[model samples]
Structures are given as structure tokens and as C-alpha cells.
Target chain A: MNHHPTEPQETIVTDMPDRPALLKRWRPRGAVWLAAPAVLVLLLALAYPLAIVVVRSFTDPAPGLDNYVWFFQSAVNRTVLQRTFVVAAWVTLVSLICAYPYAYAMTIVGRNLRLALILCVLVPFWLSGVVRTLAWVILLQDSGVINSFLRGLGLPPVKLIRTLPGVVIGMTQVLLPFMILPIYSVMKGIDTRLLQAARSLGAKPWRAFLQIYVPLSLPGVYAGAIIVFILSLGFYITPALLGGPRSILLSSLVQNQVLSLLNWGRGGAMGVVLLVATFVLLAIAAPLMRQKHSSTRREA
Target chain B: MRNFAGALALTMTCALALPVFAQETPVAGAVKEGSLEGKTLTFVSYGGIYQDGQVAALQEFVEKSGVTLLNDGPTEIAKLKAQVDAGNVTWDVVDTADLPPYVHCGTLFQKLDFSKLDVSKIPPGQVGECSVPAMNYGVIFMYKTETYKDNPPQNWVDFFDTEKFPGSRAIDGSGDPTGGLIEQAFKAAGGDPKAITPDDIEKGIQKLRDLGPDTIYWKTGAESQQLAESGEADMIMMWTGRAMTAAKNGAAYTPVWQDWLVVMDQMTIPVGVKDTDAAYALLNAYLGQRSQEILTEKTSYTPIHMDAKPQVDEITASFLTSTPERIAQGYQQNIPFWVENFDLAAEKWNALLSGN
Candidate 1:
């Protein structure tokens, strides 16, 4: 019914009459069977441990809510929790700022350069987080390379290691790829023709990019932010290695309680709180993300 | 079904034949061996060069006793507790801080069988009901020789005296606030280190805080060594072993042995270990003179055995804490006092570290 003018016409075939019969014969039993292994693995590996953690948070040392109470009551625990959120938020924002230009460059670059850029991101990805953190330590420590270079330039060496700034820089570097990849993937899917059309319609290049291209890339930014934010919240090694005593995070507190003090209930309670906070953040972000997506889809 | 039955019968025959194969007993007068035959024990220790030395030291035990030794850890006390609680205790023997075995004695660890162990060679006051001294070391004040060549800091009080020893100082911040830092702090505050009470801990913290922003902390032995090697701090309170390592790596630092805080690691048998007898045997072998000597030679940690004459190079000999003269000069850690007050001290320590 909607044939293109240049197309050669051919005899039409219809299987519509037999569609209901075929649909009636189809069963979901095979699909369910196929998914059974994955479901089992999720139950065993993820759900079981999570359930135990939740239970231990309530029951350990004695069957009471003492652990949760302690977490809320302790000024130190509360401060660390607040600090963790702040650090994660800062890392997410910084990653977003860095990743946007890198991803946009990836979208417009020649194939080889794009591949090279991707490799630059992925090479660090292949390295272990601890190795990357240690590399930062070597670069940022007082006698490390950066300070050495500053001294060589006849400049005073800046304090970098064992500081909040050092932790943020280390986290941002490690989490940059997590932010970039998602945004790049989405930006790659965005049609360039729309921006070109905006340009043709007498809009300037900057306006065309701002009005047309950026709206389409919002989904990628949101996805990347969510991923980076959640990951930064759970980060232990980078912050531990880079941050000073003042820069201690909730995960560090959890590690101290669980590993050093052997206070599992408190650690479990802290973990549960972190988990709930992450869920609450995602819950708040989800509807806003959905609204933006639907509006963008309507405009497209 | 027939094939299954045949396979089962073959397996049963092999099982029965195992004892028969071991029927050739050794001569009565020959060196008695294989006390731990057909047994496997997991030995846990803090990892890195120290653990490497431990494995090397225990090689003779593994060979002579015919026990298969599997190594694991950076020992976590929580993990040990969890394993014991779950009735699946996997770690047979654990090398741990001197305090934990004392604090959790009989609950987390078994009371060591003294009859099975020969503790004669171990230094006096080092052996406990539930643990044996694994190594002798110290948390000694080490300052950059270049910085203080004219007037070096001598004792704990000099370390805390920022005006006299002015540059940035690094102390043990790796946790366990009840360590030498507190002991030294107590001494610096005109309180005797031996007479330290939980109430005096706050005074110690105050004394340390008086050092102000000029003080830093290192959480790991490696970090302590790095601080010295990289010249981050003018003065560093470091473990003797790590100080030695940093010195060997060309850190221009000289140790101040006056009133050095003597510390030791303890070997423990975790409660509910699958084979208790084998664990004791392994512990016994670990404390042997040859084993201690090998440990000292390899790791630069001072040997526990008084008779262990470790063939150390000149550099290593200078750092060894087990020497009779050094031991006489060193201040022994009051283990029982620390053990009794660790939880209270740790809470206060954490709060202080957090700047709360």
C-alpha cells in the first residue's frame, strides 16, 4: 500500500489470516526454561547475600534495632555518610563535565581517531582500580611526579595527596569512562541531520547544537550520571588510598567496623542505609528522566 | 548400574589399600617424623614480604612433618569470628597482632597446649596462654638524619616536642589507637606508659593533637616506609622492620632507639580449626630455632627465639630488636592492659581520628 516510486512491483503475499493460529500455538514454556539458570544465579548470588545482610543488620549481637540506632546516633557515622554523598555528587558532576566534550568529540571524529580515543578510555578500564589509584598516588604524592615537575618549574609544590581534592581527582579519573561510554553510545545514535536541518533553518551552529543536539543527548547524560554516581558511592580503594583521615567515607567506616572491629551488625546497617539511599536517589531521578525522554521523543 | 557397582568396588579397594601402603614404619631410633602425616593446615598471616618469610620459615615443618601447608590472608579477625560462628573454621593457625589473641582468648582462639610446644627458647613474658610470640619488633622513632644531625630527637617526649623537632612528623594511623603512639603520648603527657588507664587515653590524644597540623599518619607498614623514602615527613614513627626496609631503600633516616616501643606478633590457633593437634604441631615447628633464624634472615624482623643467631648483614644487625642489649633498653608493651582497654581506646581513637 505504501510502495516507493522507484521500487519494482511484485506479487503480494499475505500470512495475516494464519497469524492468530500461529500465535495460539506459541508457548512461553521454552523461554521460561531458558531463563531459569539466570534466575537461579540471581537468587543464589545476589538476593541471598543481600537478604543475609539485611537480616544481620537487625539480628546480629542481639535481636534488636541497635545497629541501625548506632548508625543514626553516632555523629561520626552521620558525618561520613554525608561526606560520602557529597563526594559521589562531586565526582558525578565532574565526570559529566569531562565526559560531555570527550563523547561529543568521539561522535564527530574520523573513524581511526575515534577508535584511538576509545582505546585511550578502555586501556585504563582494562587496568585494575587499585593499580590506577596507585598510579595517581605516584603522580600526586608530595615527592611524586607532579610535585617534582612543579619544583622543576620553580613553583611551590602543592599539597595533593591525603586530601579531599586528591580523592576527587582520583575518583573522577577512574569513573570518567563509565560516564563517557554511555553518553558516547547515545550521542552516536543521535541523527546529525536534525542539527544540520536546524542550521539550514537559519540557526547558528551553537544554537543548533544547544536547541537540537543537546536535548537528544540528555538520556545518555542521565544514564552516565546514574552509573557514575552509584559507582562512586561504593568506591573504597581510591578514597582510602588518596584521602586523609578527614576524608574518610561511609565505606571506610563499614570496612573498619566489619573488618577491624568485627562489628558486623553496624557494618550491615551502614550497607543497608547506603543501599536505601541509592534506591531513593534513583527513585527521585527516574520520573524526571522519563519526563525528559517522553518530551524529547514527542519533539523528535 | 553394573559399571557403577564395579567403580564403587574399585574405590573401596583403593581406600582399604591406603593404610596397607603405609605399613613400612620408620626405624625407632631414626628422627621421628610425619606427626602431621596426611593432614593439611591453612596458615594465615598478613601478606607481602612478611608472609613470604613465614612460608620459607615453615618449609622445614612442611617437609619433616609431611603436612601440606596452604597459605592465606592478611588475617581479618571478623572473618575468623564469622568462620568460627558458622562452624566452618578454615584457618588453622593465624599470625595476628599481639593484642587480638589476648583480647579474644578462649573465644576466638584456643588456649595453646604448652606440653605440645617447647617455649624454652622464647623470651620471657612473650608467651601467652592462647598464643606464642611470632616475632620481636618495635615501633621506634626514626628521624631524617639530615634534618636533625645537629640535635636529634631522643625519646617519646622529643618526638612530641614540635618546637624542638619542628618539621612534619608521621605516626602510625593505621588503626589500633592503643598502640605505641598512645603509649608514647601518655609518657609525653607526664603519665607513665605502664600506668596508662582508659581515662589517660584522652590526655594522650590531647598531647598528640598538640603536635597540631605538623603531624601526619600512615595506615600501613608500606605507607610508613614510603613516607620515609619519599621524604614526606622529617620524622616518622615506624615499625623496626619497615624502618630497616626504608633505610635499605636509601632513606636518609637514623633510628632513635631510646625508649623504643617494643611490639611483637603472636601465632594463634583459631577456635574450631579442623585439626587442633596438627595446628599445635605447626605452631611448635614455627617457634623452632632454625625457623626463627630463617624468618629473621629473610624478613629483617627480629627472631623470637633467644638462641636464634640469625646471620644478618651489617645493615640488618643494626635494626634487629631481639639483641639482648636492645631488649634491655626497649619498653615492653603492656599487652594485658591494652587488651583490657582496646575497645574503649579504639572508640575514642576513631572519634579523635575523625576529628569529631
Candidate 2:
């Protein structure tokens, strides 16, 4: 259509060559310069401290692997680590179970109702972790509000404070927002027309949701689950406040070593192990995340 | 550029010359008026009402000595070790448990100059080579009056007797394994409390385990007080000060002072402090008669001054460990034994806590 483009061709030939060369020369340098502050911050704040912890695990009292050896050999440490993972998994699963319907409702709700639902999810996030955990303590403690209500109903007072169920309840409440927000964000982006079309094609509502909508919304579920799990692994305050001595997690162990015993080597070793375990979990989840992202892109 | 360089050089010269000037100044063994002028001392302690009382006790010193006093937090031994290791000690005087001074003496803390500190007024044996007693307190058993209406539990043995007590129990689980707990446990298990050793630690822990699943652990003074006030536990082993506070807060509790564990907080100068003499002067001022009296009145902790008498209410006086009768009934902690066996005991304590 533009075969006779003599004027445009002359302008393009004159302008394109030197400008691109100049841009190409400076672009990479500009990018490096722009990224320098973030890189420097990471090196100073994150990498340096992490390196110190790693080094301290080996060399605090003496230069050896005795700390790590002790960590593995100690039955207490092993049990605590196992308990930490188990609690984290339980919190993740519970958060996901509760967050799924709430997030799905948010995706399909009216504007005002959606805002209200979002506020419900976000208000707890605004509170401090310590304050929230303490609130749970007040509600769950013996002679606390829940126990008083149970007593009023002629029921025996249950041991809720400093128990496993108490910890799960507190952690689930704390991490629910983490699960809901991610799923809501992803669910909001999903097309509702696909579900409607499935229903129009004679599929039942439940069938349509299960066959079409749930599959599409899975990336969000995976993201929420991973995030909640990782965050719950490092939970300190909730478990400390709500869980009993038997509910001591790995973080508590680290605190015990570093603070009480003043054994930095053992504490640092526990920290390194937790960090490695977190990374391994992330590494396993990363491939699934990437695959889901690519499939979503292809569908789009 | 020349002007800036000249100014920088002059500043550096002044910075290097100041310490020399300070060294030439006469050191006052006593906290004389304005002796520590233009100096600031950072006082570190376990924060809360205790630290508030400490700050209150130091107010007179701050006024008289003109040393601007700054306060810092819940003392962490690891942080202190790091500071000492790095030669960057910021805390001039730290309030800590009695055991740390004995454990890290001459390394993390300075061995005191007895001439600078007026140790004559303090109780004998409360003074250490590196530390001086800050305040005296006790870890005593306090039970809900309603739970044991006619026959109240009397001592640590009754505390361990779940069948006799027949209620939930709470104990301090804040820091390292406390020697008081072990001593009490040993006593309860029919072992001699005075003969508690690293060997007896296992049996003590076993006795605690026998107390069973109704045992609750409180990590803070406030939590222990709350445990008593809220009726979360029937019997609470807590500080005398906290138990008093709980009673003041309307908790119907009665104290069992028999074999109560006598504990004391100690103050020590960190190793590489900026001003050693000033820190010693501060410690001296803290042990003053007026300061100790004020501390005892403001906080329910017992005063270390041998002659200081605090005008406290009847309730407060009932909890004070200073009186001769109460002191006779109390048992002093085996600080050296704990300082030596801290690590092993801590490991076992953690293992038991984690239910392994």
C-alpha cells in the first residue's frame, strides 16, 4: 500500500542509525546504574547478615562443624523441626480452605460488598502481630471469653490456651489475609464468561465450576498456599503466645539457643538449616509456579 | 578546600585531646555534686516496671552528678558478648542476673575497683568480684486462696504435688533454666535442696515432668501476674514483686514463703565502657540509702542497702524479703553451680519443654 514512500524512507534512513547506536551504548549502563542502589542494599542488608550467620554457625566458639553436628544429633532439635513443618502445613491448608470461598465470593460480589469483604480481610493485617496474637490469648485462655461462654452453656472448660489447636487457630487467623489477598487478586483477573459459557452448554453449575473455573484459579491457590506455608514456618509470636511448651517450633529453639543459653553457634546453625529448608521448599514450588504462569499466558 | 581541611584537622585534634583531658580530671570515689559533668551514662536493664523503678532510683544521681542518664533495654548476653568481642561496648552499666557476672567476669565485664564502690552498706556475699547487688527479690509460691480455702499449700513440695494441689500450675519459663526451680524440684523429690548439683538436675526435671500436663509456663513477669489474677492457674511460682502486683490487682492469693528462693539482680560495668569511673560512680549511687529506699517503695523488690528501711504499705511489707524472719525462711540460689552447669541444664530444659 505504501510502495511510493520516498519521503518516509529518507526520514527513516536519516534518523534510525545514530540514535539506536547511542541508545544501545547507554541503555545497559543506565540499567546498571539504576539497579545499583537495590543491589547495594541487598548486599549490605541481606547478603552480609546471612553470610555472617552461616559463618557463625561454623566458627562462633571454635572453627568446626560441631554446631551443625549437634543440631542433627539432638533429638529435641529434630522433633522441633518436624513440628515446625507440620504446624506450617496445617496452617497453610486451613488458611487455603477458609480463603478459597471468601476469595471466590469477592470475585463475584457487587462493588460495595466486595469492598466490605476486602476490608474484613485487610483490617487484621493492619494490626501488629503481637497484638493480634495476644488477642487470641485473651480469647482462648482458661477463664477467657470462650471458656466463660462454654461454662455458661454447662460445658466443661476446655484447655485451649497453650495447645496445638490454639496455635492452629491463631496462626490460621493471622495468615488468612496472606491467603485471601493473593487468591482474590488472581481470581479477579479470571474471565467469568468461560464459566457462563459452560453453563450455557448444559453443564451443571458445580460441574462448570469444577471443570472450568477451579482449574483456572489454581495458580492463585498455589501462590497463596506457598506464601502462607513459608510465612508460617518462621512464625514466632503466635506459637510463643498461644502454644504450650510442647508446641515449641524451630524458631523458638533458635531463640532458646541464642538468648537463654547464649549459644550463638547452635542458634546460627538452626537458622542456617531453616533458611536452607525454606529455599528448598521455594525451589520445589518455583517450577510449578512458572509452568502455571506460562500456561496462563498461552491461554490468554 | 584549604579552610575545610584546616577545620577538619582542628576537630580531629580536639577529638583526640578530649580523652586525655578526661584522664587528667580527678576521679571522685563518691558521687559528688557535678563530678560527672558533661558525661552521659547508658544504663541497661530488663525493661518494665523494674526498669522504671531503676530509673526512678537513679534520678537523684542524675540531678546531683549532672550526668545525663540514658536507658536501654532487656539485656541480652549475646548482644553483650558481641559488643565486647567487637570492642564496641555501648552499655556502661548493665543490670543482669547474678550468674552472668560470675560466668563472664573479667571478659565481658570489668572486675570492680572496691575503693570506688561502697560495698560496706551492701549485704555480705551479695557483692561479687565483677558485680554489685542491684536489688534482692524472691521466687515464691503463691496460690489462689479460693483453690486451697481451708488447707493452703505451704511450699515447693506441695507445688509439685498435683494430687494434693489438684489444680493447674504455672512457673517461670522466661530465660535459662533457673537454679531456684531445680533446687525446689530437688527438695520436692526428697533430695536435699542444699546439695543440688549438675547430677541432680535430671531428677529435678523428672519431678517437674511428674507435675504433668496441667503445668503452664509463663515467659514474662506480666504473664505470671496475669496467670495469678485471671485464675488461669491455681498455683503460680512467680517473683514476690509480681505476686504482690497480682494481689493488688484483686487476685485472691496467699503467699507460701517457706523455702522461697532468694534471688538478686546484679549491676556490672561492661568491659570496654567509655567511662569506667563514671560507671562505678553510678553503681555507687545506685546502692545509696535514699536510692535503695526509693527503689523498694516504688517497686516491691527488696532493697540491697543493709540500713535502708522503706516505708511501704502492709501488703508491700508482707512481700518484701528484707525482713529478718522472711530472710530466715528463704533459700539463697546456688549461683556458682548454675553458672557452671548453665549449658547442660539449658539443653535439658529445652528438651523437656519441647516434650522430647
Candidate 3:
């Protein structure tokens, strides 16, 4: 608000030091000391375990690159990897498509109504992942609720359990909250006046949304998609329960190797591959996120 | 500013030390200085009758030792690896599936000392280096007695002879990859289940593949029961307890114990536990004849103690697959064959299960 220039030169310069010293002066000594405990927790809880996995990946099971070789060359590993990415991509895209309208409705709706709808979405979110997945199984299994209803209506039951579509349905239901909340938060921040201005300029309602609202909401979409993808990549129970023989994701493969096969080396290697794939995806996403955000803002 | 720092320091101290402080209390001893009271000892186990059975069996231990048992369900190796990798080993005595210890033994599980307890109290050959048998159950054929009133599937061959017993069948699609069901099928097909050298596990898998689209693959015991109860499956390769429950609930199911693939869930102490003795005590308590009887009464599992006998009601007696006749027909999981051929068979099994 203060557009007018005050004294331009450093007339009232004190003995207080420059930028680095100013930062140093404000730094709380106690917080710096307290950071030790927090750092220690991070090391213990997160860093050490990850380091162990990395170390185990190398030295385990007679020590060599046999496990890693096995992972990449083996048909099972390749298939699991392929299946994991396929499932993750589908889950992310589906979640985004389903969540976008729901999120938009939440932002434009009244506060009380929005809260109620959000709570409805979040009730499943609050329910344990296993419980919700089990509910889906009850609903979707061949002789389950849905199929029974269909049968009652003299319709043949569709194969819902142990199929890719079933996996998608269960996973999307479990992950829909992660998608909706982020988009809603981003939508809330968008100024309605921008949409109004677009309309005033003779843009159709859908056109204004596409040109203005959609561009503004991209960051949240990106965030939600990344989260859903990460979560979907690591899905075990949903796929294990609902997914048929063909739907084994990488995590399940890692599980079978470790528990069923008892090959820590191979399992760890598979885990490392999974971790690396996730990291690579994240790496691509991070820079892309920055670029997309900058371009979108520039367009606005 | 000083007050904020003080509060911050206190909060950090509590946050960092609370888990340790809460878990350091000895189970059977007086609380030590700076020890946590009411330390939670997690038991990773399945729910339903099994969970109820475990609780019934461990009631005395809970009283004698002041350890709070936290029940986490079933064997999930991914979660275990995640927890171990995260350096937060939440499970103390995990009642897990048969093969997990072999996978995580020496790293995830503590090397058990059998010298202190009476291993003889266990069945002749059920003890492992890291784990002890929690209970014995099977993935066996269970048919609806009312549906197959003329004649039921007798054995593994009958299960495969679709032309003879033309109806939907359910089989386990989860758990161990190298299950004996397929091997038994191969054996019934005149392929030697015992001669299942690692090289032949593929043949066994092929035997399963031959079962083909007619087989409904049920993931959990509950799912298997659902398959049978809903009339989607006339017969199922089912967990004994699940079949018992289905039968009890008037689902018209009858277990065909012939060539049953019995797998034991063992209660083992994980590595990184500070109180091995307390864990052992719990294990010992779990093995006691009275406890075994109690577990049997509740769960329909044939508990390990040889002398343990429950006063079975007509319903319970009918469900008990451990009857001398049934026991004679059932074949134990070929653990020795599995152990020796684990590596090669494992690769082949994974390939097969993954449909490679």
C-alpha cells in the first residue's frame, strides 16, 4: 500500500549487522537445541529403516546382484511391475475424473452443506482401509449384495470379484477422499470473480470453467493424482482380496517373495525397484509441477 | 520466549521418550525406574473363532503377566517388511502363517530356545527354529451334504472329476503360493505329490491350471464360506473352521477331510524384542493342555496338546475334523519337501501364481 518512497538511503543505520547476522539474531537458540530430538526421531523412525533396506538389498542371500538380476529378467517381476504401473495409472486417472466434480460442488455449495457432503466422503476415509475394502467385497463378489440384487431381478451376476475392474472399484472407493479433499482445498482458494469476468467477456459457462477454473485447479489435481498413484502402487489387501489371479501388483509380489518364497534378497530387490520407480515418478512430477504451475499462472 | 522454549523442549522430550517409556516395563516383574507401564504386545492373528480361541487360551497369561495384547490380523509380509524397514516393530508375538518365519527368520524373528519348554507337549514334529504351532487347520474340501445327497466328492480326484460331480467349486486363491491343494491334485492325477522335486512344482501348478475356469478362487476363509453358503459353490477347498462356521450357520456344508492340506499357524517372537522370557512364557501358556482344550472348544481347531480334550457339544463334535477317522485321511503339508526345494519351487510357484 505504501507506494511513495521514504528516505532512499541508509541514513539511520544502526550497529546491527547485515542480512546473515539479522537471521542469526532472530534464530531461537532453544529451538536449535530442540531440533536434536526431532532429528533423532527422524533418523530412528524413518532414515535408519530405509538405510537397512538398502543395505539388505545388497548383502542379503549370499550377497550379490543375483536378486536384482532375477527381478528385472524374471517374467513374474516384469509382469508385476507392468501390472503395478497399469493399476496405479488407472487408479490416479479414475480418482481425478470422479473427484473433480465432487470437489467443485463442495466449493460452490453452502458451508454447512459442503461440510455434510465432505463428512459423507470422509466417513469411509475414517473407516479402516480393511473394513471398507471388505465392504466392497461384500457388495461386489459374485454372490454378494450387488449380484444377489441382480439375480433377484432375473439378471445374471457379473464377475466383479478377482478382476481388474473389481480392483479399480475397491481402490477408487478407498482412495477417493485423497483425491476430493486436495481439489476442494484448491477450488476454495480460487476467486469466483475470475469466472464471473470470463462470463462477462462472452465465454460460455463450460468454456469459462475450462479456461479459468480448470487451469487454476491443476495444482490440486496434480497433488491428488500423485498421492493416489503412490498409494495405489503400494496396495496389497484390495488387490489381494478383490483382484483375481492376473491382478498381482508389485507389493503383492514383494510379499510372496518374502513370505511365501522366503527370498529376502529377491524381495528386497523388488522393493528397491518399486521404490526407484516411485522416486522416478516423483522426480518427474516435482519439476513438472513447478513448470505447470508457473505456466498456468502466466496464462491467467 | 523462554516459556515457549521450555514448552517445546518438554513436548519434544515426551514425544521422543514416550514409546520407550511406555514399553520398557517388564511383563512379569515390578516396574523398573523410567519404564513404561501397560506395554502393548501385539499379536498378529486372524479374527473370528481363531481370535476368540486365542483370547480364551491366553486369559490366564493376561492376568499373570500384565502385558496388554494388541490383536493385529493375519500374516501380511508386506506390512511386516514395511514395519521392519521403518524400524517400528509393532508385533511382539505374531501368530503368523506357516512360511513367514522361513522368510524372516534370523532377521525378523528371534531364534527360539526349546530347552526351557516341553517340546514333547507339541505334536511329534511341529516345532520350528523360530515359531511354535498356535493351532492346526486345513484348506480342505467341504461340500453341502444336502446338495450332494446322492454322493459327495470323496477326495482330490473327485474334486477334479467335474463330470462326476458337476457343480461350482471354490478354492483358496491367497496365502502360500506352493499350497498342497494343487500338489494333491497332481498326486490324485497319478503325479507324485511327494516326488514333487522343485522341478515338478510346475507340473503341480499345471494341474491347478487344468482345474481351469470352473474353480472359484476365494481369498479369505469368510469368502470361501460365502461362496458355499450363497450356493455359488457346491463344494469348496475350505479352512476347517470356516466350513464349521458355515455348517453351524445352517449353510448345509460338510467337510470332506480326505487328503486335507493341514497348515499350522505358529506363534513366534519377533527379533528386536527386549522380553524373550515373557514371550516364551506366553508361548508356554499357549501350549498348556487346558488352554488347548479351551481353544479347541472356541475355535474348532485341533490344538497341539495330545491330551487336551474338550467336552464337545453335538454341533462342535460334528465340526471337529480331528476325529480319528478324519485325521487318518488328512495329509500334513510336506514341510521337509518344501524346506529342501524352497528356492527353486518358490520361483516356479511365483511364476505360476503370477500366471507367467
- Candidate 1 chain A least-lDDT 10 residues: A4-13
In terms of lDDT, model 2 sits at: 0.83
- What tens-digit string does per-residue lDDT give for candidate 1 at A36-149? 899999999999999999999999989999999999999988888889999999999999999999999999999999999999999999999999998998899888999999
How good is model 1 by TM-score?
0.89
| Each prediction's whole-model lDDT (CA) | 0.82, 0.83, 0.74
Better of 1 and 2 by DockQ: 2
Candidate 2 C-alpha lDDT tens digits along B65-118: 999999998898888988999999899999998688877878988877665556
Among these predictions, the greatest lDDT belongs to 2
Poorest stretch of ten by lDDT in candidate 3 chain A: A1-10
Q: Candidate 1 lDDT, tens digit per residue, B89-171?
A: 99999999868887787899987655556666677667776787889898897899999988998888999888877888887
* Candidate 2 chain A worst ten-residue window by lDDT: A1-10
- Write down the worst ten-residue block by lDDT for model 3 chain B: B25-34
Candidate 2: segments with Cα more than 4 A from true spot: A1-35, A289-300, B1-30
Q: What are the per-residue Cα lDDT tens digits for candidate 2 across A194-285?
A: 77888999999999888777766777787788889989999998898898888978998899888767788889999999989889988988
- Which ranges of candidate 3 are over 4 A from the true structure? A1-43, A285-291, B1-135, B144-151, B166-168, B177-179, B213-216, B263-291, B303-307
Candidate 1 docking band: acceptable
The list of candidate 1 runs beyond 4 A from truth reads: A1-35, B1-31
